[model samples]
Target: MKNRHTPCTECRKQRRKCIQISPDQPCLRCQKLDKICARPENCALDPNNEVECLNQEVNELNQAIQRMEHELKTLGIKSPLYIKNNTMTLPRSTIENLFYNWKIKINNGYFTIDTGIKYISDLLPHYTSIEYLSPMTSYSSSSSEDSWSDGGSILIRFKSQEYGGFYGLTGKMLTKWIKKRMLGQQALLINHIPCGSRMLLDRLVDIYFNCHNLYCGWLHESSFRKRYSQLKEPLDDLICASLCCYVCATPCDHLDFNAYQRRDMCDYFYLKAKEKLVDQFDEPDKRLENICLDLRSEYEAAKVQTGIDYALFARHFSVAYCLRITLDCVVNKPITRQPIPFPVMNTLPDELEETKDFIRVMTWVNHLYEEPFVDMLVEQIHLILIGSTCTISFETVARMDQFLLDFGKNIPSEWRLCDNVFDEAKCRKALDQTTNPVAIHAFLHFAVLIVILYVTILQPVSVNDENDLLLQHIQRNALEKSLKMSRLLLYGVQRLFKLKTLSPCHVKLTSMIIMLYLVDPIVLQCSSPIKSSVLEAQKMFQKCLDIICNIRGIQREDTPPQLLAEKKDIKDFIHNGSVDIDYYDRFPDPWCALLHDVSQFFI
Candidate 1:
């Protein structure tokens, strides 16, 4: 065996001689230290290797210098003296540290150059940039037009090529600010009972599977259980909150059951879920991937078992359920005195497929469950789709009209007659005494649909330029029929309102009153002859508004600012004897506004 003349790596690092028995074996010192013996000959340094290594290092240094200069330019530093002084040689690590500290200060609203300089100087005294000392007070603004308000919020202005004049803080800044706001907002443990209790867990799971599963069934039952059992202190909070929300949402049979406890549990868990969801949204990549994977697996299994593409359906259902639970908790709690829009109408337009899927599922579920609430939900979906801001084709309008006609045909002859000639006092007495939840829910949906139909009849129609007198006559006849239908529907609404069966604050009910108010203006502005009845109709609509506001605990002052503004314009038009049908077109339909409020649920 050849003797090892070259020292080992460790010995070379320590500047000591290495002793080895052979070239193949480790040195005694390396063996004692339990380190692998490395030989200098194994490296076999070449003249070209040294040159290449030096070049690489030099290139890295140049890149670092360029980055520093670019950063200085971005920070609005342009003084020649500062640039020359700051060009001092700095190690990569020191440059990196300075850049990081600079970013931290900017994010924290410490924007002054002098303060940044002081901070960086303390961080790296030996590697100060000459630009830091420049007395140039003015800095170059961001390429993206932005303005900082006194409130410490930055409003970014987008070009017309983008989403023009879009003003908001950057995503990162908004997330940081929100986190700072929610710093002390801890999830409250209202229930003293341990979450791991088997009895409670079983009951909650059963309730979830039985009732809430149809809509919010994203979590894989088996996987969730396995993960939940293994979770420790911190993570268990989310599990507990999620389970509790499901349990609390179950409809209880006992009249004496403590509703307050359920409310508290729902509230706490909703807050936790909302916070978690926001955090998931802010993640750079693989955001909510774990949850999505689980949901996908469940959906696949469901498709195999049910033979239906429930993937899109389930996603929307779960989202809507989450939003609904959160909104319900908030509405019941009422953090503010201002009236909140009805939760059903608050869906986002981006979730077009989701909304369609939700509606389809609701229609199917109504037949399967025969649940009054599900039926009501289907009707609400119908209203939302009809009132959608998206352009509706003639075919879609025809379909909607056909659906309404079909619905009308399904009503009992006696019920249809009662709608037009029912005794207001008797109806009121019966509604007050009615105890059936299903009946009350059904009536609410039915009445809302009637009112929506009434308003829909007044929607302006477009005529082709080539249409002759024949088409005009046909249109007039159709309009008269629609007016008759509206009058019949109005009678039903009056009876229902008089009975006080539904809350006036209920969005559907409030929207009905608004629709009625719109009817008079619409008819009066039409080319059709205005009789004395038009004046009476206007007086009656005002009376209805006054009554509903008084009954529903909504003061005139509590009305939405936009609605109030519109009402004032309408009043002014009446006073000036002017009829502007264009006024109605300018403002969004009230029903569409209501729909936008609840659209987040479907998303």
Candidate 2:
């Protein structure tokens, strides 16, 4: 009896019958062609045995579906938008009713604000307050859910405070001030929302972020809810949206392309970001040198206004930080099979092949900065100032860039690399806690983190009274000193996380990790059981070690086995100050506090 499963091609081409190996590989037929050949992809099973195979396949698929359903049920997570499982439990009539009301307010000045949105709910309770309603405390809970809070309790409403020697204006006073600023203009009044409303709406149109637009219309009093998709992809800013357009013509004059229309605006920014490093590309000196000049000019302007030499110090100020951030990403991901020891080198003392990856990332960042990165900074300044109601323009970026180039060129070689080492312990401690957000957050939020500080943290402080001028001056100095102390901490973080990789050309890499709300103070707090923050401090130190070991070139095998076995001792050689508190004792408590704060964030 001959094997019936043998392929005819195998027998004819190979001059032998097929064995039909479990993971069928190339038979002699493919060998002659010098190409990969395998069992036919769509070959059917024996027709006589077809039902058996079909039944088995059906069972396997059923088992998989069951497992997934069980997992979802156990996890208490609804498949909000999955095609098979997603369903809108809400009535269509309810949604249509809301859209009716929102339609009238689409272009209204009041709808664009924080106060006039109340009518949305009263018109159709389901869409506004009933469908997606959640409480303040609820935001702090929930997983795999989209929840964000930009302000504390005072953000949505007005609160009154008694003036008995203890006070600034109450929430009521602030509201009045903002209202007066608007002066007869309309504002939105939206606060409460419906429960599970986000889930229902997301199911209808398919979105989870709860960020896009919602339309409203007028319908029967019995049914006032309706929903419609806004016709544009969500974008973080108008500038980014304009940049992403592929249409050769200007935005208003041309039709928008729908090619990547399904992608969220946030994803689109990164997609475009990976393309130009910004919205523009640089050709060596043409792009980069022009950027540096622009930045230096901005720095000079800032310096003249405040005597803080924003231009002279900004580049040096940014160097270590930028390196840590860009390098960390590349170094940790290896190119070779070697056992990579971590506690990545905080500084590149010598150039090595392993360090190549990190250098490449650095080159990209450098190019990026010299490219549209300068534009981003300029745009960022405009955003902060405009949103906060101040005045600024691209002129500042140009000044800062020019000033920095001169300052950096004039800097002594040793100073350029932090060779002077004033209080090396301080820098190391700062370096040690670069990865921990909790420590950094608490430090930044310490003492003056009240309402006033939120508004004043980076603003100029002015006092009108002559009698209290001296006291006010002292407070102002303290704030400025604190800011400088924070910057020193930031530099430590940037330099330490630099990475290395193998690339055709040598690359220099450096970076600093800036996290969003989810993985940060929140995760930092969640990692430990203790609430006193002492546990947080320990975690900070622990995280620093993890990142150090992540450096591309540094590994246990490269160093002496004995030293590698005792990691702490080796780390001391690089940064011994981190483990010792006594050396830091001589420094002012504020400085120590800042270091402590910086360290606490990573662990």
Write down the TM-score of every candidate: 0.31, 0.18
**Each candidate: what lDDT?**
0.40, 0.30
Cα RMSD (angstroms) for every candidate in the order listed: 23.3, 31.7
lDDT of 1 by residue, 1-603 (tens): 222256888878766568888768898878866878887765445656656766676666668779977876765555544554455466777657655665422212223333354221132333234324334423433242122221233111111121110011112223343454332224445457443466665566655544434322344455556666675543235555566565554333211224444545555556765656544533446456745844653443432322122444444444454344333322322111111111121222333332333334333323322333323323322222222111122233334445555554454442332232123444354455554322333343444443333333333333344434433443344345444434433444545444443333332333444453344323332323345434444444454444433433323443346754663233332223233333332322322222222122111
Model 2 segments beyond 4 Å from truth? 1-44, 47-55, 63-603
Model 2 residue 13 distance off true place after TM-score fit, in angstroms: 21
Best by TM-score: 1
- For residues 217-303, write the lDDT of model 2, one tens digit per residue: 001111112212332322322322333321111111112222112122223333433434432322345457557854653443332
437: Cα error in model 2, Å: 33
Model 1 lDDT on a 0 to 1 scale: 0.40
The reply for model 1, stretches above 4 Å from the true place, is 1-277, 280-403, 410-540, 551-603
Residue 506 of model 2 has an lDDT of 12
